[model samples]
Target: MLKFFVVTGIGLALLNGWIIWWLWRALEHTGWLRPMLCLVVAVLGVSFPLLYKLGGDSAIEVWLLRAGSFWLGMLFYVFMLVLIMDIWGLASRLWAEPPVAPRWGGALLVMGLPLVIGCASWFNAANPIVREYDLTISTNDPVPQTYAQSPLILGVLADMHLGRIITAPRLVRAMDLLAPYKPDAVLYIGDIIDDHILVDVEGMAAALARVEPRLGHWVVPGNHEYISGSIKDSLDILRHSGMQVLRDQWRILDNAFVLVGRDDMSRHAFEGTPRKSLPEILADIPHAHRNLPIFVMDHQPSMLDEARTAGAVLELSGHTHFGQLWPFHWVVESMYENPMGLLIKNGLHSVVSPGVGTWGPPMRNTSRAEVLIVKVHFTQTAQ
Candidate 1:
């Protein structure tokens, strides 16, 4: 992981340098501006790395990663900017026209890219996207025996990505907002830790323990948990803080509602750590419970078909982060089921929360970081 940061930063710096060189060479006839640009590149060449070490990213090494990422994007923009300008200049010279504004504008835009990205540091450091998520969930799962006319309030939060850049403030607002729901229970879908994740796990544990719900609080792992090199430690904190960490298990409530959960499917793909399979869990489910209405709490909702076949009435999961930004939402829609909100298939209902918080960039566009407040009303149809 550390190597990833270093390599990423260095790679961007080199790429930026190359782009500057090409840009400078492209306009030798432009005189001092070309040399001046080269000089600027040389300064950035040395400074970006230094900035990376000082700040990277999160509170841990965010300064480095953020700085590196900014420069990387900057270089990419400049490279493309220059390349675009080169083509534009050629077309203009051939057809008789002054350089299009896009050329100079592109260069200027590249120059501002770092500043634009720089705001991300403070935005994440401040906004944190912590909000009250309150929902009443009522399930008629004969298995969990969760059959009730009243709503079961489920407080849900997910994907903090706390590490270097994040701080206590993030947790502070989260707790504050989450307090309102008077949640019967709280659910953390996954990705609780990252580079700038709060290191005071004990403190965080103590705080979360204070968040009393009617039934219980449960959590599941996300991709970042493994990436942060603190999966065991994180689960320990949750357990100590009084949260149930589900790994291929189901908790029956009201003899009807069931919260069946499994380890992140990606765990094996990324960490080479074998996770408990869904079949194993389904096998463990009591036969009586199987036919009852069940509400699952899996991480990703991609397993819609499998979940339906297994007889999950309502499955709640959060991993997509709802794209976290604008254009990405369009692309993310193609990836996850319903990305956010209720999605029903074959009498199997799945609600994918936009998530409690965001991952990288900490920016909200199409859908903001949020806690899901689900209101489940049990409806009994034929089997």
Candidate 2:
């Protein structure tokens, strides 16, 4: 962890330094403007990490965090735009008969593009859309007649990151969107709370409790839960919200299916304890219930093979944010096998949500915030 912090700090310092240099050049290297630009760059670069480390639950702190997050989003676009302009300038100098000096138009573009995109991204994040999928889980064994008659509507809410940025109202709005679907069960695939310190636990709980699914609300911790440094408190809040917190636990619902929740993989890193393996957890189920359709929720989508090997019919996950911003999803796609949307691998069905809330910047570009409604149908096949 210390190594990670040191490496991240050094990277941020270099990136911010480069931004300062670029801004100075874009502004024609005005002696009077350099200091002001450097000051702004330094402040915005450090605000998020510094304020987060200090940890306060005040409105000022919240707004400061917000400002810092926006800067981070802006920084990405600014850095990219500056780099592109610099490249263009170098190419022009090499190819053209005469190299032209950088103009005010370029500087304005560098400054304005991020603001415009940022506002659009902010609106995209604020208003979440509902994405629906249809899945059929076939079994040879006789199943509950009720499930066979009707498909189960499962609501997926992932990466809410409820805290200063994702307040109660946002959660309320998300719930309102899911109300129409009337999910039989709502699965929260981790990162539900960004940080306990910055969240209004009671308020979040109240917002969540307002909606009651027929089977109930089930949740598995995401990396952020452990990152929050108040796992117990976060779990308590979820319980208060009428959710069944599943940490390396399983429950047989209506004798129709088995729901398994694995602790976030980060537990080993943060708490020095590893979560139970997928097969190990499944072994605990009595033989009588083994043939029942299995649903697994592992926050990162890192264990799809394990779930598939364990005969799980469906696995739901969130945490990728599908890059949350453009071009970044490219990186996310390379990291996870099923980064976003649906994947049917050999038999195991996986749905990876881009998440319902933003993490740092409260902005989304690659994909809009979404709630997944998967209609799962149970069908019997001949032995």
Candidate 3:
């Protein structure tokens, strides 16, 4: 961990230096503007994380974090653009004179594009979509006659980073979107709250009370739950809000299927609770449920293979936000076999939601915030 942090710190410092260098070049002609911009950049680059971790009570602090998160999100893309421009400029020197210094107009455009994209992303994040999928789990036994007419409809939601950005209205909007599906059960994959500000926990109970998943409602802890440093409080809040919290446990749902929820991959990192291995959890399954379709709820997609190996027919997860931002999702996609959608490998099915809510900047670019209505059908095949 120390080595990881050291490397990360050095990488960020270099990125910041380059960004500052670009800014200086672009605004050099503006006199005092360059120094002032530099100071602002330095302060934000240094203090945003501190402020975000400390959180705040004042409106200024809230907006500061919001703005800081927005800028940070934009910074990566802007840095890439600036690097490209710098490379292009350097290469042109061999063919022609080092294209004269950039004009103010050009600089402004370079800066403005990222902000434009950020604003558009903000709007996109506010409007979430409901993505639906129909899945069939073939088994040795036929789907019970009782549920054949009504295949268990499951509503899967994850990464609802409910904080200042995702307020009551957004929660209401998600509820409204999922209500039409009339899910038999709704599962919250995790990250219910971004942080534990006093205001965050206030209306949570009331807000969650409005969610109506017909059969049952469940949640598994996500990294944010522990990172917020309020695991106990978060659990209490979620329970009060009417969702069953499941951690490394399995619940038999009307004997029709088994719902296995795992702890977030970062549980030990943040909370010191080592997660149970897939084999261990599967070993505890009752003999009666051994042949039943088992659906695993894991907060992160990293544990996909384990769940599949455990003979789980389906696995539901979130935490990727499917790259929530353009190019970023590309990074996320490279990391997982199933980053944002369904993946079928050797008959094991995995569905990863881009997330119904978002994290950082209240923005999404390459992906849309989504609630998934998964219709699970149990079918029997003759050997």
- Candidate number with greatest TM-score: 2
How do the residues 50-143 of candidate 2 rate in per-residue lDDT, one tens digit apiece? 7776676688877877888888888889888888888887888899746655566777798799989999999999999999999999876775
What is the lDDT of every predicted structure here? Answer: 0.64, 0.86, 0.80
On the 0 to 100 scale, the lDDT of residue 231 in model 3 is 85
Off by over 4 Å in 1: 1-87, 94-106, 113-149, 196-198, 270-274
List per-candidate RMSD values in Å.
5.2, 2.0, 2.4
Off by over 4 Å in 3: 1-10, 31-36, 92-99, 271-273
Tens digits of per-residue lDDT, candidate 1, 1-383, equal 56877897677667766667665655556778878877767655555456434534334354545444344324544565567666776898888886554444455565666457545533543453434323333333331224245656677777766555444456656766777767777887877666424455665666575568867888888777666655787677667656788877778765546677678876886667777656668777777666556667778777888887876667778888676654567777998767877776787777787665555444454565566666555555546
- All candidates' TM-scores? 0.75, 0.94, 0.91
Pairs in steric clash, model 2: none
How big is the positional error of residue 44 in model 2, measured in Å on the Cα after superposition? 1.5
Best model per lDDT: 2
Residue 201 local lDDT, model 1: 66
**Candidate 2, which ten residues in sequence have the lowest lDDT sum?**
96-105
